[model samples]
Target: MPELKKQSQVPSQEDFARAKSKSRQFDEIAGRVREAVLDEFRERAPISSVWLFPGQDGDLNGYVFYFATSDVADSLESGLSDEIEKALVRKSKELIGSGCSVIFDSHESVVRKCNGNYFQYLR
Candidate 1:
C-alpha cells in the first residue's frame, strides 16, 4: 500500500486570535502615529490627511506615515521626517507609561495596517 501524505496543519483558534490581536495593536498604534504626524505637519503647513504606504521593490518596503496633498499627495511631504520623529518620541513615552514594550515598528506597523490611510492630514 502507498503511504498517505500528511496534510498541513491549519491555524488553531489561538493562532488566529494572536494574529487578530497583532492586527488590532497595529491599528491602534498606527492611528496614534497618524494623528501625531498630522498634528506635527499642521504646524509646518496646510495638510489634508496622513497616508501610509508599504515600501516595496528596492524601496524602504516598510510603512511610511505621511500627510497628503494635491501636490504628490501633498506639498508638505518633504517636511514629514521631522513630524515622524516627533511622533515616535511621543509614542515611546506613551507606550512606556502604559507599561508595554514598544515592539518594533509599533508606529509603522500601524500605518501599514490602516490600509495605508492610518491618518488624514485634512486642510
Candidate 2:
C-alpha cells in the first residue's frame, strides 16, 4: 500500500486578519467609486437608477444604469448612450485607478433581472 502525506500548508490567524483588512479597504474604495459614478450619471445622463455591485470574482466592480424605456429611446436616437458609457468608464478609472464594466438597460429589464436583490443609487 502506498502512504499519502497529509497537507501541510494552512492559513494562520494573522493571514486571515490581513485578508479581512484588505477586503474592507477594497469595499471602502468601491463605495466611494460607486457614489462618484452615480453622482456623475445623475447629473449628466438620463438614467432612472444605477446599481453598483461586486464583480463575479469579487475583485472588481460592476455598474448597471437603468433608464425608462422612453428615455432609452431618446438617448439612443441622439447617440447619447454611447457617450455616457464612455464617460462612465473614464470616470470609474479616474476614481478607482482601474476600469470596470458598465451596463445600460431599461428599468423594467433590470428590475426583472435583479429580482429586487440590488441597491439602486437613484429611483
Best by TM-score: 2
Q: What's the true lDDT of residue 43 in model 1?
A: 70
Q: Which stretch of 10 consecutive residues in model 2 shows the poorest summed lDDT?
A: 114-123
Name the candidate that leads on lDDT: 2
What local lDDT score does residue 27 receive in model 1, on the 0 to 100 scale? 58
Could you give candidate 2's per-residue lDDT for residues 58-117 as a string of tens digits? 334554555566777777788777776666567657765666666666776667766644
Summarize candidate 1's per-residue lDDT along 28-65 as a digit string, tens digits: 76567557656665776444344332222311112333
Q: Hey, what RMSD does candidate 1 come out at? A: 10.0
Alpha-carbon shift of residue 47 in model 2 (angstroms): 3.0
Global Cα lDDT for candidate 2: 0.65
